[model samples]
Target: MSDPTTQLTVLFMPESAHGPTNQCIGIGKVLLDRGHKVVFAAERSWEGKLAPLGFVEALVDLAPPDPGATDEAAGQFWIDFINETSPEFRKPTLEQLASFVQPTYQALIDGARYAEPQLKAIIEEHRPDVLVEDNVVAFPALVTSGAPFVRIVSCNPLEIRGPGIAPVFSGYAAADPSGWEPFLAEFDRTHQETWEAFNAWVQEQGAPPLPARDFVHTSEVANLYVFPEELDYTDARPLGATWHRMDSSLRETDAEWEMPDSFAARPEGAALIYLSLGSLGGADIELLQRLIDVLGTTEHRVVVSMGPRADEIRLTANMVGDAIVPQTKIIPQVDLVITHGGNNTTTESLHFGKPMIVLPLFWDQYDNAQRVDETGYGVRLSTYGFTDDELLGAVERLLADTELRARAAATGEAIRSRGGLRVGADVIERVGLDHVRGRG
Candidate 1:
């Protein structure tokens, strides 16, 4: 049973197109069902995904006008567009509460103003005892600037963990925190700038500047890792704050969700390898062509989630086939995943005990790949000068090495036995209650 002392209100934002937005929603649902008051500060586009999940209140339209349908395809085009047109838009748009990107800052401020009246009303109406928020929108930083509430930072694996965890990048190690001080400093610096910028915006609206990342280090701010604990990640041991592992609502197989009959005819008993560059940026055509050339002849049956962007690439005679589904569903069935090393996707693969071959393109992908490489659980390959041989070599190594497979499986088993949901629930309850007790 939940504690009677404190009521929690969570502000969630799913910012990026390929981001782990649903994971945030799933965590919110778990809290909401437990009788906490939760509110999501998200994009209008996420409305359809959130409405069914029982979120009645939201501070909506946190992004620009839908990038239009032209940006609907998540692949090389988007990556090229981001690089060509606007490089800073990717992380800042998602991470910053008030971005420095010109009109973007103005747009967010305006959006905040539009959302503030409604958000203020909800906060006043609900009188939440605590607030949990994604670091993306900095809603916690904005709304509870001086208010008293436990602030929990919600994020996927790489964003939250120490070095060598979930392969987001390579310098941090789980066993040793001091080893990655430089990277940690950089991470803190990035957050500091983001918060300072956000504080400037808040001050512009006549609100006081709150503390920086140091606030998070204190008991008042807690860190909650949202990926399933069953995943073999680096430095998963939670520190002073609580840790919550979210269960993927994705069932192994659902009768309603349909795939092509030709693709789904029968399970290929061989080691099932799933390939998805994720929904964000990737060299769709080149990577797809390379995969087709290599995996087509392999002993493993490959299933590719083309992610709508690179659907045109046809598999050669060697590959079994491919399908397009959320990786949450696909990773469970596959034996290994070849990905662009997005933290969420990597964690999903590890959650299911599947080994991975990380081909990072940009942002946190390289970081995630580095973690995988350093840990010996997987190999990280460069896509910058990728060739068919390089792709084939990585795939072959993952398939041939029994030790890596066993290690990955062992890690997965350890995570499964840890009671992911229960631990997470306990953390949430404890932290939320602690906030109330502090008031007393």
Candidate 2:
């Protein structure tokens, strides 16, 4: 429980992306409800978005604007990068280490380095009691600012390695470690120089050194990852006392959604499915169109969150879509989901008891997709190579599987009833307050 009396000023620095920022919003709401101050530190592109939600927005640019660029949004640099390297996503994960992962980390490292001076300035300006970050890389200024800091792992929990566990980015199965060595070899080969340079720089700024193969430093005070109990991998490798698992951290802030009259007017009992590739995945118009064509032939009605290229793509007669949808609101109303296995969508689907056909594109998405498939909560198919039947069949089968649906419902009830939102908020409150008092 929160003190409800001691109102601590807290600063949140999330990677300027929707997934991590959304997770922060969920927990931030809890703090707001309890009368604590919550502030979100982000780049200028994100200024207007957070302030409306009652969070104090502290905007700091990671880099100056490009000479010719006009439109701006959170993680715009990454959005452009992902689109430019879309072809690399088609390659095997092993091959991607050199082509994609290394460069991605390099960009993140550059951003972190450039933002350090600004981060230091922000800390001085805000003088927060606690600082929290939901990011893949470390920001030394947050740790060195003399405030208690918390780490939120909104990615797959496997990102945190342990004994007997598979390597972080590899989608290899836990029951079999045969593939782990090659993946680690590739990761180290591609990232060792980059990691060492960043690690050295991090230590120079008075923060702890990152582990050999990791980018972010674990918080000594508290660390939290979003994952349900049934799906967590603690049996293989535990993160010990300071770490906690949040079954799901879904926000309550999404606008209410209702089935469009076109779909609502359909005869009762018609199956409804949602197709979303997330922001990055949605930019692949060709792939989205192919999926839409196949799903159009089914007896199902579809709703699509089409990302940035929605205007360029054609939709089927049975489909309605937008560049973005009220995803949390839409999930509960759908029987099935065709998703890119992004962390937010995967956890949200499980939280709503909706079965999924996961098409993983890159990063920990592969991990989420494989876990859902192996754990029986959903099915996974290759993003680039699945045949129309392979895609449609998974949808048909999941929709027909009463046992799986029942298990999903029960799991979702447990996840919902316990309220991971509240759990996350409570842990943060306790950790922040305790650490601050200990310092005193």
**Candidate 1: clashing pairs of residues:** 163-172, 167-367, 167-368, 168-367, 168-368, 169-367, 169-368, 230-415, 296-318, 296-319
lDDT of each: 0.55, 0.87
Which digits, one per residue and each the tens of the lDDT, describe model 1 over residues 1-440?
47655566544444434354555555566677787766665655554556666775465544345454442443444556545633332332223222323333344445554665555655666555555444333343334533443333333355454424422333234555553655445546455655566667666655445555322222244445545444335345344433444432222222232344444554554466788876644335556667666788765666776644455577764354333565566666667798887766776677677888887655556556766677677877665466778877787778778888887887777665664445444555666576567767
True-structure RMSD for candidate 2:
1.6
Worst lDDT run of 10 residues, candidate 2, spans: 69-78
Score every model by TM-score: 0.71, 0.97
Q: Any idea what lDDT model 2 has? A: 0.87
List CA RMSD, all candidates: 6.2, 1.6
In model 2, what is the error at residue 349, expressed in angstroms?
A: 0.5
* lDDT tens digits by residue: candidate 2, 1-440: 77866887888899877888898999998888889889888866676888888999887777766767656543465567667988998998899899988998898888899889988988898888888889999999999987788899999999888778777767778789999988998898999999999999999999999987899989888888998887889888877898988999999999999888878777665689999999888887788989999998976899999887778778888989898899999999999999999999999999988888999998899898888989999999989999999998898899889999999999989889878988888888887788667877
- Poorly placed runs, candidate 1 (over 4 Å): 1-11, 14-18, 32-38, 57-59, 63-127, 140-196, 203-221, 226-238, 241-270, 317-324, 433-440
The lDDT leader among the candidates is 2
